[model samples]
Target chain A: MELIAERGYRRTSLAAVAERAGLTQQGLLHHFPTKELLLVAVLEARDRWDLASSAASAAGSWRTGTLAQLVDYNATRPGIVQTYTVLSADSVTEDHPARAFFESRFRAVREAMAAVLRAEFGETLPGGLTPERAAPLLVAVMDGLQLQWLLDPQDVDMPAAFRDFVALLGRGGD
Target chain B: MELIAERGYRRTSLAAVAERAGLTQQGLLHHFPTKELLLVAVLEARDRWDLASSAASAAGSWRTGTLAQLVDYNATRPGIVQTYTVLSADSVTEDHPARAFFESRFRAVREAMAAVLRAEFGETLPGGLTPERAAPLLVAVMDGLQLQWLLDPQDVDMPAAFRDFVALLGRGGD
Candidate 1:
């Protein structure tokens, strides 16, 4: 991931990745057959890490707690967000290997978010404010915030903005 | 721009751009000394087109009317939005030329939006929400909406979402 971040994915090769991992190319290939597979593994690892960290942060009362923690977590790991942004942009092309990976990842992430929202709000949300409807909005906000943050990290108050947005959701605004 | 869109920017060249534009390579070089300069021109052209369209659409009423028009205009230009997204992602590197282009574009767009918002609500907005603060939120929402639209265009009701979000701002939701 660091290599890809420093030098783009197209320039980073499997051998370089293996070298970075302190393993022979053959040994790395035994675990992951192709560079695409390795990229997927890297993405999955990041996703799992995010979920685990979010879950741990929400251990007690995520439902009632402020959403600032989640926003702060994202702020700390801009690299993961940048990777997804870069890969997702590339994946928009029909033949990009990571296209399917991002599609599935997006679906899974949205589902998990919707589930969390459903659990939190229960039946109080307004009509048509179902998890499915809200999930896209939430994800969109995150993605948009990341873009702005990348452009001008100093200008974007990620946690504050997210907290306000979440509070508006809680209030059933609009 | 078409060449870069068709063939990824990294793969495209000044000669191709000149060929596409029906100009000599020296002529193109006279205008843009480097590939990065050409890309910046393309990005600026895109920004200018979007701004012009947005201004035309938003020329009438300052409140709901203009907001709706802006959303409508954005909905009609998915390609332009995608171009911006792709370029912005690529411009994350410090040395990327599109970085400065986007930074300036973002500032200019936000200023235009802030002027619109200020014209709409003036000093009477609920909670006295300044256009500066509201502008960033509105831009964030728009940026976020584009991502969702790219992923699943059918799933997002762009006009309705923007309308509702703006309406909420008119209230004290900000």
Candidate 2:
């Protein structure tokens, strides 16, 4: 993941991964036969970490504040955020192996977010948007802030921007 | 730009760019000496197109609606957006050639956006947030929406979502 995050997926070969992990190419191949497979594992591992941490923080349920807390947590780990930003952008192509994973992952995220919004703001949110409609905007803002922050951390305060967004959500219907 | 957008920066060579442009490698390199230089030229060209269009649309000044119009225009050009997405992600590295360009561009964009917001909503916006503080959020949402729309055009309505964000901004102090 670190290799791919630094050089992007296409440039990061399995040999480099083996070298970084201190394993022979054959040894690495034995564990994950292909680069694509290794990528999938890396992605899955990241998701697992997010889930475990979220679970640990919220007792297995994602609250409205969970997303904000997650943003705060993300600020601490530039590597993971960089990896995700690089891979997610790469995955948008039609032939990218991670395309399906991100597509479904977004759908699931939107649904989960909408549920959280619904819990906080009832059926409809501010500006006459349903939770479903508001959910994607929330997701987009977070992802987008990561991109801007990664580019210029001195200017883009990830956590403060996220808190402002949360405040935006809180003031939506009023 | 299309070749890099499709294949990503590291994987794209001068040969592929030359082939796409119907020029020999030497011919292409005559203009852009190295791959990094070529990438920089492509980014600058894209920005030129944007400035040209924006200037043409708003008489050299941007308005609140200009952002939405830009998003709508962006929807018509998936290739450019994809190139930007791919390159921007790749540029997050500390030493990427385009790093300074994006950093400064964001600074300029945020200042310009804050100016627009202040013009439209005065110093303090809804929720008592200043326009300067609000500018990055607007920029973040626009870029974020692009990522989601690029990934799932069928499911994500880029223009509508942007319009919705504008509406959110308008209702900020109401």
The candidate maximizing lDDT is: 2
Give the TM-score (vs. native) of candidate 1.
0.79
In candidate 2, list every pair of residues with a backbone clash: none
Q: What DockQ does each listed candidate score?
A: 0.38, 0.51
lDDT of 2 by residue, A3-108 (tens): 8657754567899999999999999999998776687778789878887767644565576688888898889777768877877887775578778888888888
Per-prediction TM-score, please?
0.79, 0.87
| Chain B TM-score (model 1 vs. true structure) | 0.73
- How large is the i-RMS for each model, in angstroms? 3.4, 2.7
Candidate 1: fnat, from 0 to 1? 0.37
| lDDT for each residue of candidate 1 in A40-102, tens digit (9 for 90 to 100) | 778789767655666644564444243467668768766656666666765654466776777
The most accurate candidate by TM-score is: 2
Error of 1 at A172 (Å): 3.5
Q: Report the Cα lDDT for residue B5, model 2.
A: 54
